[model samples]
Target: MTEPNGTTPSSDDDQIRKILETLLADDEDITARAVARLHPSIKAASSITRSESRSRLLAEYQQRQADYRRWRRRVAKRSGADTATSLADKDVRIAELEATVQLLTASHLAMLRAIGELGGFSKWAKFYEHHREARDRLAGFGAIPTAPVSSMPAEQGGKKIKR
Candidate 1:
C-alpha cells in the first residue's frame, strides 16, 4: 500500500527504521546525558513561564484593588463634603432666624414697657382707640379690666379730701 504522498508503506517504514537504528547506535551514556540536560532546560523554561504569569496576575490584582480603594475614598469624601455644606447652610438659616426672633422679642418687650409706664387704664383705652381689631380680639377672649391705684388718699378725717 502507498500513502497519499505516493511513498510505499515499506519505504516509509524503512526510513523510520533507519532513523531509530541511527539513534540506537549512539553511545548510551552520551544520549542519556544529553537527555538529562535537555529535560532540565525544558523544566526551567516552563517554571519561568509560570512564574511570569503569576507575577503578572498578582500585579493586575493589586492595581485593581488600589483603584477600588481610591474610588471608595473619593466617594466618601464627596459625601462628607456634601454633609458639611448642608450643615453650614442650615447653621446660617438658624442664625438668621435667631436674629429675627431676637429683634421681634425686643420690640414686643419695648411695647410692654411703654404701656406699663403709662396708667394701665389710659394705656388700654389708647390701645382700644388706636387698635380696634386688637381690642375686639381681646374682648372676644373676655379679658378682665384692671384698675390702677392712686398714691393720694380719698378721705382723711370725715371731711372732704384735698388733692
Candidate 2:
C-alpha cells in the first residue's frame, strides 16, 4: 500500500537487523554450561546439600551404574553359553540323522539287490498279459488285440518270457 502521496511503505528489515545485532552481542545470562547444572533440582528430598553429602550421592550413583553394566555383561555371557549349548545339541541331532540315513540307504540298496536276484523285472511280459486279459473282457468296445509275448524274439537277456 502507498502512503497518502503514493510513497511505498518502508520495509521492517532495518528493525530486524538491529534486533539480530543486539541478540548476537553476547552479555550476561548466556553461558555454554547446561541450565540443569546451574539450577539443579529443588525437590525437598533431593535439595542441594553439603559437598561431602553430594560426594556420597555421586559415588552411590556411579556404583549403581557400574552394577548395571556388570549385570548386562553377565546376561550377554549367559546368552552366548546358551547359544553354544543349542549348537552342540543341533550337531548331535545331525550326527544321529546322518547315521539313520546311512542305515536306511544301506537297507534300500540291499532290498534292490534282492529284487535283482529274483528275476530283475526287466520285461513287462506278465503285466502285458494281465492288461490284455482285462481288455479282452471289455471287448466289442473297440479293444484292439496286441501281439502276444511269445511272438516277440526269444532269448532276450537269456531269459524266457513265461506264459
Candidate 3:
C-alpha cells in the first residue's frame, strides 16, 4: 500500500537508492552520518582486539609461573635426595666406628685378663725383680738359677695348686 508519501512499501529499495543518490550529490551531510554510524563498530573492534591481547598476556604469565613452580620442585627434590644420601653416608660411617670400638674393647678386655692371669701388678713387680736378680747371677757366674720350689704345681680339687 502507498503511504502518504505515495511510496509503496514494495518501493523501499527504490526510495533508499534515491536518497543515497541525493546524498552523494551533496557529499557533506551523508558522510557525517556514515561516520557517526561506523564510530561504534570501530570502537567495538578495538575493544575486542584489546581483550584478546590481554588474554594472551595472561596466558603467557601463567605459563611462566608454571615453569617456575616446576623448577622449584626439581630443586627441592634434588636437595632432598642429597640429604638422604648424606644421612646414609653418615650411618655407614657410624657403623664402621662402632665396629672399630667393639674390636678395641675386646682387645682391651683380653689384655686385662692376661695381666690378671699373670699374678696381677704387685706379683709382676716381684717377678721382675727376681728375673733381674737371676740375670745378674747368671752374668757373673755363667750359671742360671734353678726353678723356684713354689713354682711347682699339683692338681687339687679340680684346680691346680702351686707348691
Candidate 2 local Cα displacement, residue 2, angstroms: 73
Whole-model alpha-carbon lDDT for candidate 2: 0.44
Best by lDDT: 1
Better-scoring candidate (TM-score), 2 or 3: 3
lDDT measured at residue 99 in model 2 versus the true structure, 0 to 100: 86
Candidate 3 TM-score versus the reference: 0.29
Model 3 is weakest, by summed lDDT over 10 consecutive residues, at: 40-49
Predicted model with the maximum TM-score:
3
Off by over 4 Å in 1: 1-78, 121-163
TM-score of each: 0.27, 0.28, 0.29
Model 3's number of clashes is 0
**Full-model lDDT for every candidate:** 0.50, 0.44, 0.49
> Is 1 or 3 the stronger prediction by lDDT?
1
lDDT of 2 by residue, 59-134 (tens): 4444655666666676677778786797799999999997886676567545444544455423433554758775
Clashes of each: 0, 0, 0
